[model samples]
Target: MSKLVFQSVAVNTDPMTQPTPTPALSAPDLTEIQTGRLADPFSLLGPSHRGHAGHLVVHLPDAQRVTAVIDGTAYPLAAQAPGVFAGMIPPGSAYILRVGNGSPENGAQEWEQEDPYRFGPVLGELDEYLIGEGTHQRLWHVLGARVIRHEGVEGTCFALWAPSAQAVAVVGDFNQWDARRAPMRPRGTTGVWELFIPGVAEGASYKYRIIGPDGRELPLKADPIGFGSEHPPQTASVVRSITGYGWRDAAWLEGRAEAQDRRAPMSVYEVHLGSWRKRGDRPLSYVEAATELVDYAVDMGFTHIELMPISEHPFAGSWGYQPVGLYAPTVRHGPPHEFRDLVDAAHARGLGIILDWVPGHFPSDAHGLAQFDGTALYEHADPREGFHPDWNTCIYNFGRREVVNYLTSNALYWLEEYHIDGLRVDAVASMLYRDYSRKAGEWVPNIHGGRENLEAIALLQRVNTLTYGAVPGSMMIAEESTSFPGVSRPVDAGGLGFGFKWNMGWMNDTLRYMEHAPIHRRHHHHLMTFGIDYAFSENFILPISHDEVVHGKGAMIAKMPGDAWEKFANLRAYYGYMWGHPGKKLLFMGCEFAQAHEWNHDAELDWAALSRPENAGIQRLVRDLNTLYRGTPALHARDCEAEGFAWLDGGATDISVFAWARFGGPGDDPVVVIANMTPVERPGWRCAFPQAGHWDEVLNTDAAIYGGGNRGNMGGVVTEAVAHHGHAQSAQITLPPLSTVMFRYRGAE
Candidate 1:
């Protein structure tokens, strides 16, 4: 008997549509298909035709019987090779493959399923063209696993951009984790491999098995654009659909611009979700945080809740800074939809949510983007430009157009998909310069022979431009520490186009000044006033972030150089100074309540510390500070403008005291802030006022409620008819030891 085989047929969509006379399958083809090394499984497998005969092939490993059922008639398929079955049937007959596995130990078990290879390519010409040009603004649309109906069959369409790979296949537990079961078709010249697999739907765990350009099989790689990942320690890309999340934040989204306006008061409470609170030994899930964390932020008078990073990461220690799945919110908390719930929960409570986005570098995990196609596909090939020595991670190859497309779209995805109010890009300083934290010769200079990373700068600008342009009212902030010019300016205006920049200089100088003992504080007086010199250079956020209170830095209370009583007072005073300063504010978790110890990512915050009167006082002071900062327009309206501030006395270095005035627009009330840095009470000390009138003490760090000495100006004081420090009105006030007092001017007496 002559065994009939056919030549590989090219079916644009479905192989069953075309009936043509063809030669038989070669021995080499059978061998290739058996070993999972076949270039095009579509040609060797699935249903094809030769005149009136429809030939079908399926690799049903260990199957005792393989049958093709066409409109109720059964046609048995014979084995051409080990588990490789092929036979003839009526040409153009639509059929499903049925395989039977019978064993002595177990009863006969049979399953019937549609052949995946019978379906055609899901990608169209437009997708191929845009992908080939590396200009796919919606790159995620065509790449990665997407559940869709293809050729009238509901299944998942798998696509990947591995131009350098010799072969690629989709592998999952459904196929017994065998790559040989499903090889993908390469679209011409686009460098994209695609396959539409019937019965492979959402919730399936999958990864790509690639034969690299060197013909060596690389480690299984997780989907670069996967929307979900297996909880770490067992890495696999889960087929979780990111669509159909009906957002309840439309109202909030509409008014986000006004809420995030630079002039608007923005008091952010930054938190690391894993360590913020815990149920037992585990962190609160995103669903639980939706209630607890959101309510807490609102109760604390915060306008926004800034999460450190919810992006899926391999190591919890990295705190999501080294995210492997940027699209997937970490399963450590909850799934993607639950994270969306967290965002919506915040908006429902009138609190905006900001994500600490990390685009500067990615960790080199085996299943991650590292050596994706047996090449440095997502990072630079040269270690000098590719590797981050400081963090021991991989710096992105921003020069590649595809890489740029990937990152830029990722930013937009978070904003559009999750309803995130803003993204505070982390470690931006590292991306701005090529020589960051590197010895001179260890880094590569840009084309201009400068230390600046021009490519990275362009990528940052594009991401900002794209995200803002796509998602209305989306803020792009930079965690930039350098003196880079125009960091918060628009890209067209020769800047990185960030909405705001973290005032790292202010944080450093102020913390250093506060760390010094009171007697020696006179020498560091300039540090306290130095920030005003460039306060308005960029729209700034005065961030006392988590970085300050970790890794031997000690808690905020520990940083104060004094005895227990003075420590609480110093912290309360510093909080006052921070609130009175001219900038948006961000306080790390635990810092608000004066956590007695350094932050540990492994444990929840020292919530028990608030039981102490002094600790509770710090918490009370923060709540009052936020209340005052928000309620008083004079303190915040011109926060980013120079005209809003006036130094009444910056040269009171000998007394370690400072006084400043904050103003709003014309006819608005003016607020005066006076700080007494020393422990000695200076009674009858006169301070300047903008107008001669009765001034009400709005907030005093030394008030009894805040565990203070109760030495303020008896609720309200009338200015005396005396000139002082370039002001028309002067007030004889008692300066409480290590205290800060805020006074709002009332109408003229």
Candidate 2:
């Protein structure tokens, strides 16, 4: 390689047309640019000047001849060193690089392209300040690969935060995956590296090649704020524009903002999209699921559909719990816009969509946030504080301002970008406590030396406040299993600030009571009554979630200890009992029809089982239960209030029978529920009634339509003015074997 020097030569009177002296380039500059280790590639390459004329320098690794093309006129460039070319041109705003195969005689190959390093910084100072302060609530807009127009040229702008990295570059197919050609320019003190490549359009796949602070090359990392990604098994982030989606759910959104009251009926169908239903061996696309899932939910009378996590993950077995891409929806079904379409279609059909969001911990995949920039940037440095024992994953460093901002903004992203109705925050118990699932000496205490994770608490509170304040009528629900106080209360009032909490105690006790044989049920009758002790402690949702049926726990139907026929009857009775209980209801996908097999994330539900009368009957019973729950004010109007429920006879353990009365508001008649746990029928059982004229049997779980023995009151019974069970009116009714019976009070004749 030979060194080349240019002398100053005055030509024309016009400064723009005059030839000027060229700036000298050292050996270090050429080596740094060629080796892809330059922190600021723009300083040494692209358009520059020593005096009046413009100097264009480029590092084309394999080219023999290079030219600076200005207005279609090609100016031959002299070789400063091997693969390095420099030349002077008349000062101009725009130019392109033209190259030819090795020596002109060899005639290798040639191409012309716009220079990426010619553009100025794409982000403003405000973005840098906000991101540095960790208050950039709209960080996604600045950090991701976005298709943008710059300097009258159209292309994509890629930015990433890798403060600990010595250098970073954008590598993609456009550059033959070479990191040297697209080295990013680091903004001052912000730790952000950015580059705008002209002509790089949407759908281009890219990844960041980062050089760690120690001058060692790290594995290529996916864009943490990428809007889209290549389907799994391929980890490259794809440049996708999230705009231009036309939403047609204005009426639904308007009504939701005004009418999402706590007292209204909310029967949710929790569905794992991958396993809900499959087309042959493949899961349905978001568009297909939008129609199929929405219609099914509407017909079943469910108020909302709660989906398991849809964030991008490497392993399907995690069921989206161990997410990698917090911003990009998993491409398993479709792109980000299709997810918006699904949400819009659901709202148009009068069905609300709640996403199951996982923010507690993340999997320890190499390509993920683990050891990002060769440091514990997203997690704690201490193993006790950062590692999750149960999952073998990494706990987020909530104490870090940037990490907190990342998570909090992600919560808002779903609500604002995708129009999600609610967020069912998963594993909130794990986030609330520092010693979760850990024994003594296995965890570190907080600043106050208590189990509470103060940082996580503050993060949760801030996210909840932001969600409720920004998105009208959006819900923030917690799946917390601990006895943490006031989870659903306002943050100012000393609470975690959740809209509702999963009633895990109720689910556990009720399932335990239901698992007992008829002869042994009386001994454990308190289990069924225990939930009411703290039922109104918080706004609750009685969720029989997917967790109950997976692992070795067996299906809900199989959990009952009985003969096949008895099992079906017991499940039906339980369903009626749960619906009548005071709280909103949530049933997992297959549980509505009592799927015989435990839920398998890999396989679809047993839809063929519905052909069996027992299973079909369970389906019918659930549909009617939802209809009754929604239509009857006494059953749903005051679900979260104590005034709605009154125990009629919770102590009838000898015959294993329980009765309760659910009331609406004042002047509204009450509905009485009687559940017989034993197979033996109780005849002429007198139950209490608030009013005196007559009582109508509204639902009978043992009706022959539900695959139970046809046993119930004829139709209606007139109540006599006799005091019984602490009520002024009493009625003699026969309770069916292993059944639940509900009756509505009629006015005086």
| TM-score for each candidate, following the candidate numbering | 0.95, 0.95
lDDT of 2 by residue, 668-737 (tens): 7789999999999888998887778878898999998989898889976788888988989888999999
**What lDDT does each candidate get?**
0.87, 0.87
For model 2, what is the error of residue 395's alpha carbon versus the real structure, in angstroms, after optimal superposition? 0.6
Question: What are the runs in model 2 whose C-alpha is more than 4 Å off?
Answer: 1-18, 49-53, 90-92, 102-108
Model 2: lDDT to the true structure: 0.87
- Runs in model 1 deviating more than 4 A are 1-23, 49-54, 89-93, 103-106
Per residue, candidate 1 scores C-alpha lDDT tens digits across 670-728 of 99999988887898988989888899999999998888989988887799889899877
lDDT of 2 at 474: 90
lDDT of 1: 0.87
Clash counts per candidate, in order, are 5, 0
